[model samples]
Target chain A: MNPDLLPLALGINRVILYSGYVLLAGTFTFWSLVWPQGRKDRHLLILSIAGIALTTIATVAGPMIDIWIAGMTWAEVFSPISAAALFVRLAALAAAAFFLVDIVNYPIASWRRALPLTIVVAIAATMVASSNAVGGPWEVVKLVATMGHVIATAAWLGGLVALAAVLIPRQYLAELDKVIPRFSIIAATSVVVLLVTGTLHALAIAGGFQELVTSDYGIVFFIKVAIFGAMLLMGNHGRKYANGVALRAAAAARASKEAKINHDKLTKGGPGMHSLAVAMGAELAIAFGILLTTSLLVFVAPH
Target chain B: MSRPQYSLPNLRRFLGACVVTAFLVTAVAAYYGTPEPLPASVDTTSDAAAATGGPADQAPATVTIEPEPTAAGVELPSEGPGVSEPGLLLIAAPLPDGTWDVSEQVMLAKPTTSLTLAPADISRAGSQFGFARPEATSVQVSVGEQPVVIPEARVIEQVSADIPSTTRFEISYRLDGATVTTVPSTARRGIGAIMPVTSGLDPDLPVVVMVVGETVLSLSCPELSLSERNCGTAAGDEAMILAEPLPFGAAVVAAQIDIPRL
Candidate 1:
C-alpha cells in the first residue's frame, strides 16, 4: 500500500465527516435557539442521523486505512509515530458520539443546544492542530488560523445546507426573517475569519504570489478563492431577500393591518421564499466546490 | 423559471449533485495530477566493465584464496582480481546454526562471534575492478566487542600490502535502483576513501564503493547509537562518512575485518 494514498483517503474521509458534522451542528443550533416552536423537521432529523452514521464509519475506517498504508498490523497502531493519527481518530469518534447523542434526542431544546456543535468545533480545531498546515513556524498562530479556517468553512457550508434543506422545506417564513439575517451575520463573520486565516496559511505554505500561480497547491488555492467569491455573491443575494423581509416586517408592525397582510404575502404566499432557497442552494453548491478544493489542497505538496 | 422547487427532495438532489461534482474533481486531481515517479537506481558497472574489456559473463565471479597468505600470519582471503595466487575457493553456504556461514577461508575462527557475509560478485581485468549487489538485502555481518575504524590512507597501503600508486577510480552509489556515479580524488596517492554526502544513497548497503587498482575494499559500518532506520540521515550520515575508511592497522593485525550489511 502506498503511504501517499493515506492522506488522500484521510482527506476525503474528513470531507464527508466534516460535512455531516457541520450540517448536524448548524441544523440543531437553529432548531434549538431560533425556532424552538418550529415544526418537527423530519428531514433534518433523518439527515442528522445519516451524517452521524457516516461520521462513525469514517472515524473508524480512517485509522484502519492509514494502518494499512503504513504497512503495519492493527497491533502497531499504538506506536508513538501513530500517536497523532490515533488522537485524531479518537477525537472524531468522540465527536460522532456527540452527534449520535444529539440525533437520538431530536428536537429536545436543551439537548440540541450548543454542546454538540461545540464538540464538533473542538474536534475540527484538534484536526487543524494536528494537520500539516501547522507544521512550519509560529505554531500557535498557524494552529489558530487553520482552526479558524476549518470552522468557518464548516459553518458557512453547513449552515447553507441547513437553510435550504430544513427551514425552506418547512416554509418557515416568519422564522426566515429572523434566522436568515442572523445567519448572514454568522456567514459574514466566518468569511472574514476565512479570508484572514486563509491568507496567513497561504503565505506560510505557498511562499509567494508566483508560487500561487506556478505550483499545484497555488492553482487549487486560487480555485477555492474563486468558488468562495461565487458563494459570497449567492450569499449576498439571499441576504438581500432576508433583509428585505425583515424591513417589510418592521414597517408592517408600525403600519395598518392591510400593510401587514401585504408583508405576509411578500414573504409567504409569494416568490420571495422560493428565490431565497434557490440562491442559498447555489451557495451550497459553491460550498462543495470549496470543500473539493480544500481536499485537493491537502493532497498537493507545498513547494 | 417555475418558482424553483425548494422541497426537501429537490434540496437533497442539489446537494447530491454538488457532492458528486466535488468527488469527481477530487478523484481526477488525485489520480491524474500526482507527482512524478522517483528515479530508479541505474547500474552502469556493466558498461564500465565492458569499456575496460573486463568479464562479459553475467555469472558471479569465483574467488580463490591464496594458501601462502594463511601461512603469512594474515588469513585474508586472496579473492577476485586482486588475488595474486589461487588456493581455496570462497563460497557462501548454510552452516548448522541456520544462518549462512561465509567460507572459513575469508573469516578467522572466533569463539564469541560469528559473521555472515553475503557473496558479492566482482568483475575485473588487470588493475580494474567492478562490484555490484543487485539485491536490496544481503546476509548480516556482525562485529564483536567494539567497532573498528579504518586507518588513514597511508596506513591502508601498508596494511593491504599491494597499494596502487596512481589508482584511477570512480565511485558510484545505488539509490532506489538508480546508480549515481562520482569520481573519487586520487590525490592521496594511496587509499583515498569514498564517501557519499547525498541523502539519496542508502547507508546500509554499498551506496558508495571504492576500487583500489584491481582490489575492491569492503568498508565497515560502525555500531552507532542511532537506529538502523536513522543510520543514513542527519547525524548518522555524518558519522558514517567520518567512519568511511577501514583501520589499516587493525584490518591487517586482527583475526578478521568487518564489511557493510546491505
Candidate 2:
C-alpha cells in the first residue's frame, strides 16, 4: 500500500467499525430500555445482524492494517498485547451472538436479556481502552473520559437509530405515546454524557486553542463538533414533537366521549409525527457526518 | 382514524440538506487549515531545471568545511574553511582507546523559520542489514553571529531574530565514536575501512566529507546498487562523496578509506 494513503484507508476502516458498534449497541439499548417489544421487530433484528457482521469484518481487518503500516514481520504481528486484544474482541462477539439468538428465539426473562448488551459493552470498553490510552500523568483521567465518550455515543446514536426502527414502520403507532417519552429521556441523558466526555476528550487531545486552529486534526475535530451541534438541535426539535404527540394522546385518553376517535387520529400519523420523523432522518445523516470526521481524526495526528 | 403515510421524499430532502452542510464545512476547513508542505522533502531543483531547459546535472553539491580540527593529528581540509563545489570533507581522528572520533561540517540553505539538525528515531524498517548511519551526539548551528540553540528534540528554531535571505547555516556534529569496518582495498596495500556519515540536510545533492588520519592511502565511494552513482573524491586526508538525489528511504553516505597503518 502507498504509505501516504494508508492513513486514509485506516480512517475508512474506523468508520465501518464505529458504525457497526453504534448499531449493535444502540439497537440493544433501545430494546432493553426504551421498548422491549422492539426485540421482536424484524427491522431491529436486521439492524443488529448488520452490526454484528460489520464489527466482525472490522475486528479482523483493523489489526492487519496496523501490522502492515508498521511493516511488521509475520512473527512480529502476533505480539502478545495485540493478540490478547483480538482474542478478547472475538470471544465477546461470539458470546454476544449467542445471546442475540437466545433473545430472538426464546421468551427469556428480563434479567437474561441484559447478557448480550453486557457482552457488547465489554467489547466497546476493550476497544476504547486499547486505542485511547495516551499515557501521561493524566492517563487515568483521559482513559475514563474516552470510555464515557464511547458509551454515550453508543447510547445516543444507537438509540436514535433504534427509535427510527420503532417509529418508521408505523407498526407501533398506537404505542407511540409510551415509546417516544422513554426514548426522549434516554436521549437527553446520553446527550449530557456526550457533552461532558467530548469536552474532556477535546481538551486532552487538542491541548490548546492554537492547535485546534492550526492542526489538521483540530480542524476535523471542530467540524465534528459542528455536526454534533446540528444533531443536538435536531434531537431537541424531535423531542418537542414527541412530547406534543404524547400529550395529545394522553388528553384523548382522558376524554370519555371521543377517546377512541382522537387516539386513532393521533396514531394514524399526523403532521407532528411526520415532522418528528423528518428531524430524526436529518439527525441520522448528520450523525454519519460526525462519524466520517471521527474516522479522519483517528489517523490525523494531533499537533 | 386514518391510515399511515410514509413520505420518502421528506427523508431524502433532510438527508440531502445534511450532506450539503457537511460538504461545505469540510471544504472550508480544508481550505483554511492545511499546513505548508515540508520544504526539505520537496525537491524543486530538478523541476526548475526541466522548466528552464537546462541539464539537471549542471547543479552541483555545495560542500562546507569547518576550520577547527575535531581531534588531534587530523588536518583541516587543504582547501581551507569555505564553501566549495562538488566535493565533501570528513575528518576521523583516532582517540586513545582505538575508536575513531569522526566529524563533518556542511552548509545548509536557510529555512524560513527553523531547521531540524537530526530527526528523532532515524532508524527505518530494513535498516538492520545496511551500513550504520552516523548519530549526532552534539550539534551546533549558527546564522551569521546568531547562535541557534539545538534543542534536545534535535530541531533548531530561530525564534529570536529574523534570518537573512543570504544566510549561510554552518552546522557541525560529531559521529559519536564511529567504529571503522574493515574492507579489502584494490588501490593500495593497506587496511581499508569504511565509515558511514549521516546526511544532516537534504539527501538530494548531499555533499559529505570524511577526514581519516595522514596514513590514508586511497578512497572510493561504492556504487549504491543500481540506483545511485559513485560520487566519492579523495585528496590528501579528506574524502568527499556526492551523488544524485536519493530516492525516499536511502540515507547513508559511505566512503572507503584505505589506511596503510592504524
Candidate 3:
C-alpha cells in the first residue's frame, strides 16, 4: 500500500518469476534432450512447450503494446484494450505453467495422463489469481510477466524433475552417458532462455530501473536473483561433469570399442548421473518456491 | 522412461467436472449474499411524491411579522433641492414592501404566503393561520403572483384602566440618521403601545415585553416600517443589553416567549 514499497514488491515478483522460468525451462530442455524417445518426440516437447510459449508470447507482447499505446498517449488503445490484453496474457501464462507442470510429470508414453490434473491445477491457480485481480493496465502486465516466469519455471524445473527422476534413471551408465550430454545441452539452453526472459519480464512489470533500487519488490527481486545465481553455479557444475568429462569418455569408449574398449574412468559410478538429477530436482524445487512467491506478488500493487 | 498415462477423453471429463463444481459453489455464494439498505424518511418523501402523481397544490399558508414602530421615521422636510438635512433625526421608517419588487427572485421552489406565527399569536390576531414555520407553509397561488401579500386591515387593542404617570418612563428615538425624532409615550385607553426604545435596538424586529399590569406587547410589521429594524443584527439580541426598569416600569419583556400550540 505504501507507494515507496511498491517497486520493491514488484522486484520480488520479478525475481520469483524469473527464477521459476529458468527452473521450468531448464527441466524441459534437460528431459527432452536426455530421453531418446523425448528427443525424437516433438509431441512430447509440445505438451509443455505450447503453453509456455503462448504464455511467454502474451506476457512479452501485452506490455510492450500497452506501453507503446501509453507513450502515444492514445487513451483509445491503452485505456481499454491494454488491461484486457494483460488479463488474457496472464490467464494464458498460468494455464501454460499448469500445463507445463503436468506435461513435465506426464508418463513417457501418454500425455493424456497429465491433462486432467493440469486442467484442475490450471483452473485453480487462475481462480486464486482471479481472487486477486489487478485493477489497472500495469497490473495486467505484471500478472502476465509473472505467469511467464512461473510457467517457464514449471517447464524447466518441474520438467527437469520428470527427466532426472523418471527418464534418466531407467537407463544404465552407458545410456546415462548419452543422456547426460543431451541434458547438459538442454539445461544450458534453458539457463540462457530463463535469464533473458526474466530480465525482460522484470523491466516491463516493474516499470523501469527506478523500481529496482527504490522498492521492496526490488529488494525481493535481488534475493531471487541471488538464489538464481546459486542455481546457475550448481547447474554449471552439473553441466560440465555431464557434458565435458563423462560424455567425452563415453564417446571415446564407443569409438574405441567398435574399433574396441569401454570407458570406466569417465563415470566412476551411477552417482554422477544421480547427482545431476538431484541437482536438477533441487533447481526445480527452488523454482516452484519462486512461483509461489510470484503468484503472491502478482496480487500486490506495482509501482 | 515410463511412469503412467491416461487417455485424453478421461482428462477432458475431469476438467469439465472441476469447472462445473467451482462455478456452482461461487453461484451459491453470490445468491445468498445481501446488500445494505438506505434511510426511511428520504425514501418516503421522494417515493410518495413520485408515486402519487405530484404534490397537492391547494394547501393554505400564512406569515406574520412583528409590527415595527416606523423605527426610521426620519421626517425629511420635503426639502429644497439639496438642502441641509435636520440634525436630530429621532424616528426612522423603512421603505414600504413596494420597494425593489424583488419578489421576482428565481427559486427552485414556489414560496407561498403562509401564516408563520406561534399558535397563540394566530389566535390573538383572530386568524387561525395554521402554518407554524415558513418552510412548512403552503398557499395556493396562480403563477406570476406579485407583491406576495397585501395588508388586509390593522388590528387595534383597547386599554380599560387609567394609566399612571408614576408608573411611566420615557426614551427618545433618533431617526433619519440626524433629524427625524419621536418622544416615547405611555399606553392610553383607546389603544395599546409598545415599550420605549431599548439600548438603541431596532424597533422593526420582533420583541416580547410585558406592559405593567397589562397584556404583553406584540406587534406585526410585515412592511418593516419600524425605527428599531435597522439598529444592528436582530432586535432580540440587542434587547439583551438594554437597561432594565425600576419596578414602576412596564412588565418584563423577552424574546422567544413560547405560546401553546393549541
Please name the candidate that would achieve the greatest TM-score relative to the true structure. 2
Clashes of 1: 13
Which regions of candidate 2 deviate over 4 angstroms? A68-70, A74-82, A106-109, A207-216, A246-271, B1-168, B171-262
Candidate 2 or 1, higher lDDT: 2
Task: Mark the regions of model 3 whose C-alpha exceeds 4 Å error after superposition.
Answer: A1-133, A166-173, A176-193, A200-207, A245-303, B1-262
Which candidate achieves the best lDDT against the true structure?
2
Indicate the fraction of true inter-chain contacts that candidate 2 also forms.
Answer: 0.00
lDDT tens digits by residue: candidate 2, A105-191:
554347856776676577777676445344333567677888888887887899889878777776666577788878888888888
Q: lDDT for each of the candidates? A: 0.42, 0.53, 0.34
| Residue A250, candidate 2: C-alpha displacement in angstroms | 6.6
Q: Interface RMSD in Å per candidate, to 1 decimal?
A: 20.3, 22.2, 30.4
TM-score of 2: 0.58
State, as a TM-score between 0 and 1, how close model 1 is to the true structure: 0.48
Compared with the true structure, the alpha-carbon lDDT of candidate 2 equals 0.53
Q: How many Å off is the CA of A22 in candidate 2?
A: 0.1
Best by DockQ: 2
Rank list by lDDT: 2, 1, 3
- Which rank order by TM-score, best down to worst? 2, 1, 3
